[model samples]
Target: MSEPVIWREPVVEEWIDYNGHLSEPYYVLVFGHATDAVMDAVGLGPAYRSEHDASLYTVEAHVRYLDEVSLGVDLEVRSSVIGVTGKLLWIWHEMYADGRLRATEEVLGVHVTGGSSSPLPDEVAAAARALLVEAPEEASGQIALRR
Candidate 1:
């Protein structure tokens, strides 16, 4: 299997929870940003949307929270394309904080245009396929978990 795409970010003060660790919701937000990066890489970003009047929409997500993340922590999310169909894309993300696996997010998304389902763009499909990887040991856990 190939290496998962690494999406990195620093935990700012605003991301901390009352317990002094990263908030639960922030985990999903960070992963959302990482997903945006993946979409951009696949030619489904803002420019593509502007030009084609189409965009990718998250259809479903199963987010698992495994550990805690503290403020000022550096986070790196390793994401991989689990699979893709004609109009759907499946993705997985493993989030790490201080080198510890802290969270995982699995998502299914669809391409849409004019308020209706649309075919995945060729460039987007090619990119997602190129980034596909075998599910890591971590991914074998529960398919869905609460934030």
Candidate 2:
């Protein structure tokens, strides 16, 4: 499988900081929202929370901001499953603008229920596993396109 575009939205006015670039926190926000889309795709969204009283909690995260994302441009988050465990999921996201690589975010998350760690529900686990993509044998982390 390949990375899928999990979420996208324009860089709006409010996301801009006094320096005229996307604010530090908004970078997290945009990537975090993309993670939510990954959860939702795996049947762990609002409906799952309503039915199972469970949700995934972000356990660790790392964001590398590579370039400036200008305002009013649409930012696309391409995501893929890195790995999965009995109770945790690992995901990666790459944010882009005008086809330029902008940022990369990786997160580790755990399923929680009743305030304690819980086994990931079957539906979500299956969906996530189906999307897993291993890095190519000779792949560079950055898939840059040159002119």
Residue 18, model 2: Cα distance from true site in angstroms: 1.7
**CA deviation > 4 Å runs, candidate 2:** 135-147
**How far off is residue 10 in model 2, in Å?**
0.6
Write the residue-wise lDDT of candidate 2 on 86-136 in tens digits: 899888888999999898888889999978999997878898898888843
Best by lDDT: 1
Scored against the true structure, residue 12 in model 1 reaches a CA lDDT of: 92
Minimum summed lDDT over a 10-residue window in model 1 is located at 135-144
Candidate 2 global CA lDDT score: 0.85
Each candidate structure's TM-score, on Cα atoms with residue i matched to residue i, is: 0.89, 0.89
Deviation in angstroms for 82 in model 2? 0.5
Over 4-64, each residue of candidate 1 has an lDDT whose tens digit, in order, gives: 7778999999988889988888999999998987888778889888998898899988888
Q: Give lDDT: candidate 1, residue 132.
A: 85
Per-candidate RMSD, Å: 3.1, 5.1
